[model samples]
Target: MASAAEQLAANMNFGSFQKASELHKRIWFTILAMVVYRLGTYIPIPGINSAAFAQAFGGQSQGILGMFNMFSGGAVERMAIFALNVMPYISASIIVQLMGTVYPPWEKLRKEGGEAGRKTLNQYTRYLTVLLALFQSGSIAMGLQASPGLVDNPGLFFVISTIVALTGGTMFLMWLGEQITSRGVGNGVSLIIFAGIVAGLPRGVWQMFEMTRTGALSAFAMFAIMGIAVAVIFAIVFVERSQRRLLVQYPKRQVGNRMFGGDTSFLPLKINTAGVIPPIFASSLLLLPATVMGFLANANLPAWAQWVPGMVGQLQHGQPAFMVAYGLLIVFFCFFYTSIVFNPDDTAENLRKYGGFLPGIRPGKRTAEYLDYVLTRLTVIGAAYITLVCLLPEALIGFYKAPFYLGGTSILIVVTVTMDTVAQIQSHLLAHQYEGLIKKSKLRGGGRGR
Candidate 1:
């Protein structure tokens, strides 16, 4: 019967997108909202000389700016209003997540407060995003004035106009993300980022082919590199879905005037609990200085600025030092972000309060310690997995010169989000089937009684 249902779903067409009509409405709303986001990316900010700004960006050597441009879907290069994308929100989220681990006030709020506290935290994040957007926008505006012919005048008008425009863009993108989550199909913010990367694929491929035609790259190497990337993506999908399940048992207890019986359940721990955060943070920290260096590399004023690029270029792509630092950062952030996201102490306390235990482990501090210990080991493996998935293929596809979109972080986000979205769809489908079954059973019983 399940197989038949699966077959039916498989044969579903666009019409079946509305088989569950309410969910279909939500999906269409999300698509429409995403279209608005894509449209805004093309709307350039006012006052900047677009052609000059384009030349300035094009002339600069590749650095962190390239990655930033990738995330923004070329908006930064175009000096578009939405050039900042959703990065400010992402940064704010990271800050709030870190504070939740270290700050007592935040910790208490996380533990004791429910939906209200979450809403408060979210509000704070939004406020932080606005502040960050303003500062970053101002900096970019000043930086633009430094470029030759990029601005008509270095005055308050241009600075204020750019700042206001960029800030408004970031805020609008945030609202779109909220709409996607509430009304659309997948995660709004992640889909936004994914769309940017995907939209750049054709351009990246053309550039690589251009290199090949110019004799800078070999066709054989390009083929091999693409094959390797495909293999790596598949591997990431497999490993991310794998899990370790620990058997958990609950002891029955008498409470007040009620007799409650315990049941058994399993605690599922993923191999990679930190998800895409570790690599993202690691890249942000490691590449930020490189971005600064790239800006200063061609500047005339300072000796350090002129010499820095050559010094850092020693650790260029495929270099050992760069790989080592990237791997180590991935490992460190795996532990750090995991510690921020999951609190074993809280989990242990909740389990004890509910009369649950992990097999032979005691129900209090010991259990907490045990969980931490196990988690540490898993994290070590997880970090190593992430590093390998990101770096090894990076080494393999060194010749393809493809944008690093198929690496660990991208794969992690794609896999985790896909799993979550599929689970939601399955839940809806199951609910629909169950309701039909219940109705049929009721009708049968009624007919027999009549």
Candidate 2:
């Protein structure tokens, strides 16, 4: 039976792809857009010593900047035009979303003002991104000076040039992401990150092979790393696809002896409601404190300052403390952001207005309470799933010196985005199929009547 079901699925998938010309067009556009994005990553910004910059980055690969570089596809390492990527924009978005929850004015705007408020918020986020880019660019410039040969001019010219270029580059990438979302498949920002991970894969693989060849890494260790990566991916897929289904019942309304409206449906609550945001936010926030401490410690400082870099360095890939903290943060943000995004009260009210009620529950407050209960349980399971997926394999990878892209967050993003895009395609195909059936039915009816 299992083999037969697999065969059936394979056939259905083949048919879907075979006739999905529209889907093909959308996918090709997405690919082209990603290619353009990857190309932009390679275009270096002006006024920096490329060689020294390379060496500095090479030395700092085990630090917080490694995560940033991975996101940017080595753009940050090279100080390319897209060096900043869309991270600052993403950071601004999270900040604005959090503020909208706490501040009454922003909350009102979110609920009532709608599109206009959204536009205002988007503009504000852009301005915030610019500020963040400026700050980052300045810090990077100062860090460059610390490595004596990293800046070609090593003065005002280099600083001004880098600040302008990195800021413009980040803005350009934001625009590109918008274009992809409007004109292509999948999310633009997500696709950009996906492209970076893919581009860096070959290099990562080569480095691992080199380590093995040099006998620094063992054959068993290499096999273990590969096995762990596969397992993590499978775990991510399972958790991401998992959901809780609540049965909703609609009562029959009788008019003129005709019975109607008796139906049942399911409201699916995803296991991982917070998605990739929690881990991404955790990484960004965690990196900030470590980065600042390292910077200050670089100055005329105490012995503790020297220990700071080494401690942070250990935390970068797979140290126990880092893993524990990373997992806990993922779990915290999962619940935190889920609370902000999903409101059971509003949902239950809407269901009541629509004449729908959950099984074994009242229409309003009781239903809301039920939903809240279910969601909380699901969120706990989800947070545990996310934390495990993120931390454990990453710990193992650290044992083997594997790349960060193999971590849980990357797997989550890749799997979630792939699922979403494929679902969109399937919806389009289903709609087309229904339209074709309707047209055939109409033609047969007209012929019979004639």
Clashing pairs in 1: none
How many pairs collide in each candidate, listed in order? 0, 0
Candidate 1: deviation at residue 145, Å? 0.4
lDDT of 2 at 203: 83
Q: Report the lDDT tens digits of candidate 1 across residue range 1-450.
A: 346567555554555445677676776787788678778889998888888777766654244566667667777787788888888887787788778778998877766778888888899899999998897787677667655577887789998999999999999998888888877776778777767666676776677677778987788876766676677678777777878777788888789989787878777777888877776666655554554454444444355446665745634556677678888988888998888677899889988887789988988999999989988888888888888887876655443445555444555555666676666666565555556668999999999999
Which portions of model 2 show Cα errors greater than 4 Å?
A: 1-24, 288-315, 434-450
Candidate 1: Cα lDDT at 329: 83
* Candidate 2: clashing pairs of residues: none
RMSD in Å for all candidates:
4.2, 3.9
TM-score of each: 0.84, 0.89
